[model samples]
Target chain A: MKYPGGIKKQGSSSINYANRGMNFEADINVTNSYYINNDIAVIYKKPTPITINKVDYKSRVDAVITEAHFNTPSTTDYNGIYKGKYIDFEAKETKQNYFPLSNIHKHQIEHLNKIVRHGGIGFILVNFVKLNKIYLLEAEKLCSFIESNERKSIPIEYFENYGYLIKPKFNPRIDYLNIIDQIYYGGKL
Target chain B: MKYPGGIKKQGSSSINYANRGMNFEADINVTNSYYINNDIAVIYKKPTPITINKVDYKSRVDAVITEAHFNTPSTTDYNGIYKGKYIDFEAKETKQNYFPLSNIHKHQIEHLNKIVRHGGIGFILVNFVKLNKIYLLEAEKLCSFIESNERKSIPIEYFENYGYLIKPKFNPRIDYLNIIDQIYYGGKL
Candidate 1:
């Protein structure tokens, strides 16, 4: 199997072996770069928001931030144009059996709802790290679950039923776009 | 005329007075908020990209960045869904009679070009602050100019001729969408 960093693993029958000890965010970043290079999409993870309080201008191009504080992001971490459609999503990795709603902030959910209302594609990617399973849950279904149930977390079964499983693959790594094509683009891929 | 901060300025017939002493980025931020509040669009200026070097987790909620450095953005400053279309643009305020191409990074232009190629609306908003004139130049025209000429900057005449003029408004302040509607949506606004 093809592993990350272009290394081939001999006799590695499972995808988990390839992803073992790899960072989730880094994997997504690589996948995004792959998509960009292949001219497939233009998705990007937004920079972590911060409020700068102090800076040291060492030179014209060497200004170093001395003090800053993280600010709550008002929108999803990832967003861009995909096939002429506005795609927005947040991704998180959990080591538990259930995906906690608290992993996403309240304002972020509202922001996703607004995106969906404005005719943009909005969803969340939750990776059950321990189970080595990932699911892409649309904003509509997520909001429905929040409204209908009193539970703070969504079980794996619910994801298996409502969310689309994102099987890990070589080259692009996580093939979430495969599911996107199936669901939104009439299986054009 | 309706001034910034919702203050009504009397006997000011020109849009220049309303924008005098006001920061261009702040004006766009206020305009974006107005668009969001009115459900007109979902555009936003991305957070300034930075490379965090060190952080101090004083407590669970109060982690402070002690060292960081600004990183050049790979994409435009603003992008979002507008009328079910992917909208991407970079905004710049130039006090000079010509807008320097150096104001926009090389990769940013490439990124916008890719966006337009992928069926997204891509443009650059050049606000000639001194003339109180703002123009939205589409990616096609911008790239054409870059390809045909050896000029380091675009003259104000080029903007006046080829770019869509964005007139200042009361509630929305910088009404670029008004121009977008006229150009792309058959003046649906």
Candidate 2:
């Protein structure tokens, strides 16, 4: 199979999923690089956990993992320090008008909650890809919505009301720290 | 080859190095878990980066990585929130009297320096494994030493003068955070 730009795709649904996931993370990675290069903030995406099953040793100093499997992460995807404050978040993208709550795992939500309780900034960046809209919703607000409503998904209206819209840019791409400035520092930046 | 306690050696110096590294990190993990369980702090070691070379899919949802290699990390190992402050640090163990500065990469030192400049706490935990001595040396102190000294290795006298000794405990093992409290909070705790 071939994807756009003449890149051959391995015939696997998992590869497609992996590619899609990488796109979102790659955008954030570029944004983080811009921030780091500019001395603005130091944030990083945590690498995905891989469980090694087998390793082949070529020499005493050289070894290659021959088999491994992806493992679930216990924390959010991204976290770091911003202006001396602990900044933590998870980024997800959805094509639907309603964001499914199941898109986030229970442990991840708990981790976010704990961050907020520790006086660290915690939020979620939801990219409505079809709508070309990005929203930064506080972890507290998401938790409240989940606790109060019996709905399995959060409507677009809730995000519009409570979440801050992050405008995309050319160099930094997502410009999420702009939203952070508004939310945490009273738009000082 | 077989190691003691019925554990089989993986017949690779890299594996031996990995096992030795994991022993130090595992102790820190247990300590972090203790702090987390006690609501003292939330710290975690970032997962290692692995470059995936090939994947084998058995089903639509299942995929196994067939070939991969470990990649170098851009930042320090451990980071988290402690008492509403961002804490970042790297841990290194040495068997010699003089700790070699080459053990830390340039980029990692830059990362630690950035963390300090941004008003976040950053440090290095040096464990003299042979002597069973763990020292928590502040990032600024380490940077100044590196910048001022012409030598490639930091002598034990430097650590004795500038670094706080972290006493090992029964439950948490490496209680470096205790030194952190002493350094940062005027020993209030």
Candidate 3:
């Protein structure tokens, strides 16, 4: 059985919720790192938010966390500056044919809305594993979809219609920034 | 004895390192909340980075982390969009008359420099507890100091000369944004 990208794999030898969406996340991290190194952009994946409950001071510099729990993130998973523009986004993947709106939190959508309203770029990267396609859906477009339609999940057709397809490639892997450049900067890059 | 804003109080009932700089962090959190509520800007404190080891999934929704370790953050503590500009900064407080260079990690400085080079507004908020003063030191200015001088720490006088003093007040306690307005937008707000 194939697990979707975002779902946590249970009872695995490597039990890390940080690896919830390992493949997609790894792709994005590689892309962001490449962007930073090449001086094309300076984007970073915000660390997974976790609430610490107990810690043992093994040493001053080395503290071992004994208890903790992951908290729902208040903001997007990734954000940074690209071409002097504030960029923010959440990356997700699904084994299904459609991208589920439930994959994103309500407040995250609100946060993205606030970012866009304040003149920052905000979007979501949705990867359809079955279709072998990735799409960059702007927050504005996503919000309008939610408002116009009562669909809980965004169908592949909607993404094809409104979302910009990001072609996967070597080196940078997921070239979302190229799509951003095309849409926002008229392919200036 | 008054504990300075950034130092962690060790071994006195509470041991969560998240409280390493509680007073100053709380103040900033409150200030950022006020900004968001008032539609001023969209800034947020990135969560403390942690490397999760083991987890106990009591149920699907609730997962308890059994073992973990705090990771040194690669980027600054706070970042967001302010007035259609990318804003990034590390907030630190020093008990000494001089702010020590050791408080900030080396790579964080590099990260800030990259942000500034990319045309983002990058700065550091240094709170001097004894002096009862806070200063917003721009990344460019800080880099110049680091390059020109071999000084291990920045004297309060340097802050007085090179940094914009942030006057503490009610509501938005740390009014650093006001300083940004004065410097960046000529006090337009």
Candidate 4:
């Protein structure tokens, strides 16, 4: 397990003892649960898509699952409805100044576009590990960066120029919709 | 992977697949994806609810996921929107003449109750794997079976008496919604 800034791992003395990878997705889920419980919004992270086959329950009928695969070519990390509006975005973090284009795939970008087309707020949550800075960039800006002559990442300078910084926190952390309120609802929250 | 209705494996071929145990979820996902692409409806199998932490990238900051756990119980197996109406249901398969109550959890049953309370459609796609018989049982009736102390499952006689059977098909396979139309709506396809 790693820290919020993606720095040192959790010490052996820490509470968790699981051998599983840091529950990054679980944290978002916890955060989403918080949102749902508070009646603040209803958003959820899509599950890691998988296919199943060959379900063999001895007492139960042996079910045959033919094939399986991860459905998304890229990430559509978070999505839900808030205050009657749909919200969709991907959450990503890198320990570099410039987040790479490799993180955002073409298909993922298109997925965001689809979200926007359907009248949902679409954006990406990017964390600059070294700088310990996080920003929420809209789909339009992301598309331009991908389609730009650089044909690559959006420089840190560009992110600093255009992105809204997100402050990481504790207690159902990564409360992104607060930022969503600012961007989509014009800072009412 | 071994097939449910296919030949069994021997000669020490261990299962080393990510989707080793259950392919029922995967098949439903593929079937759902095909349904989504065909504009049949926008349904998605909820991703495995996970907790993420600890990420390390050379040039970029890693998003370290700290802790994780298996599924933390859920309300439905799949959810989506069809014709602007919320669709929710749990998928269960049994080889017996009756559907066992043990197949469902209390929380899941409660979840379906809430969905109906909120005016959304709630139901189950029950497949008798060995019998190759599928039924679309309304949540209302299910709740009744749950409320009674007479038995822990819906007897086969009851299914044959009241449940809507969903025959497996190739194109637009498992067209359960067609039955929904007949039951929930008055028109026939």
Question: Which has the greatest TM-score?
Answer: 1
**Per-model DockQ:** 0.89, 0.62, 0.72, 0.10
TM-score of chain A of each: 0.92, 0.85, 0.87, 0.76
Q: How accurate is candidate 2 locally (lDDT)?
A: 0.86
Checking candidate 3 for backbone clashes, the offending pairs are: none
Error of 3 at B122 (Å): 0.4
Give lDDT tens digits, candidate 1, residues A1-189.
455467666543544433532577887888899999999999999999889999999999899999999999999999998898999999988889999888999989999999999999999988888788878999999989999999999999989999998866666877778889999988953
Give model 2's docking category. Answer: medium
TM-score: the better of candidates 2 and 3: 3
Taking all chains together, each candidate's TM-score versus the true structure is 0.94, 0.87, 0.88, 0.60
Off by over 4 Å in 3: A1-22, B1-22
Docking class of 4: incorrect
Give native contacts recovered, as a fraction, per prediction. 0.89, 0.81, 0.94, 0.13
As a whole number from 0 to 100, the lDDT of residue A69 in candidate 4 is 33
* Order of the predicted models by TM-score, top scorer first: 1, 3, 2, 4
Write the residue-wise lDDT of candidate 3 on B18-53 in tens digits.
332448888899899999999999999999898889
User: Model 2 reaches what TM-score against the true structure?
Assistant: 0.87
Point to the candidate with the largest DockQ.
1
Q: After superposition, how far is residue B177 of candidate 1 from its true place, in Å?
A: 0.6
Ranking by DockQ: 1, 3, 2, 4
What tens-digit string does per-residue lDDT give for candidate 2 at B1-189? 554466565543323333333488788888999988988899999988778999999898788999998777799999999999999999998989879998999889999999999989999998887766778899999999989989999998899999988754555677888888888887743
Residue A165 of candidate 3: its Cα lDDT?
90
